[model samples]
Target: MKKAVFLDRDGVLNEVLTERVKFVNRPDDLYLLEGAAEAVAELTKAGFDVFIVTNQGGVGLGFMKERDLKKIHGRLEELILEKGGAIREAAYCPHKPKAGCECRKPNPGMLLDLARRHDIDLSASVMAGDHERDIEAGKKAGCKTVFIGEGETSADAKAPSLQAAVKDILQLLAD
Candidate 1:
């Protein structure tokens, strides 16, 4: 029964394109938010298995190719490792928003799968993200939830940024 932290990819791990309000469509568009790597490293050092659960609907909308998304994730992993972090795995929903996909955010499919494969304890796990859908997924998956950024959400906790969120999560784990 290992603990795990599931993170949202876009706003949680990287800077989302604010002007366009969309996912990073290319590797060039990808930018790791400040302190993100260090925060992840801290979580990794805390002994929690880190994972990414995201809804990459851009692939289904033809905004980006699967290979391009892979490239972005590859670079992200490299950056995290460079900062002394370890990501156990990443799972994403490539279907369109209205595709009724089981793996999308707001659904527990991805989290459930990760728990099954990694033998994770859902009760001891945490899900951190910037959107309500992320919180919803976590709740449905039976894990505590952390919401990043300012907003009205049903998350168990809230923070101004991913770094802050991770710190709060660490405290929760300690308790």
Candidate 2:
């Protein structure tokens, strides 16, 4: 069985406009958050399977087209690769928050599917994100959960940022 890491996209992998331009509807709006690429690189170099699972509700809400989302993801991949990080795959749920889709955050569909497809052991995996839904999904998927940023959580661990979260994850993996 292979160990893996599942990461949320918007706030975890790239910048999220908490105060402005929240949707990241355009490719130009996509930017790697501080230390994000390097952290991902470290995770990949450590021999764990890394995947990005996100809920891009903007697509379903008509804020961005599917092609535009593709462009943003392409740019994200390029940036990560430049920093020597490799994302095995990225899966997103293009549904509105109220859509009640199985693939969205707060649901384990994406993680479960990825584990099945990639032959990953959910018990040996970690799911890290900045939202409660991310934690819930991870728990549902049977992986350890790490919550990024400040907030109340039932996550197994918490960190101030994605980079910090990765550091803790690496430490936990080593223990």
Top-scoring candidate (TM-score): 1
**Model 1, residue 167: C-alpha shift (Å):** 2.2
What lDDT score is found at residue 112 in candidate 2?
A: 96
TM-score of every candidate: 0.95, 0.95
Instruction: Write down the lDDT that model 1 would get.
Output: 0.90
Q: Give the TM-score of candidate 1.
A: 0.95
The root-mean-square deviation over C-alpha atoms between each candidate and the true structure, in angstroms, is 1.5, 1.4
- Give the best candidate by lDDT: 1
The total of clashing pairs for model 1 equals: 0
Q: Candidate 2 — which residues are off by over 4 angstroms?
A: 18-20
**lDDT by residue (tens digit), candidate 1, 60-135:** 9999999999998888999999999988898999999999978998999999999999999988889999999999
lDDT of all predictions, in order shown?
Answer: 0.90, 0.89
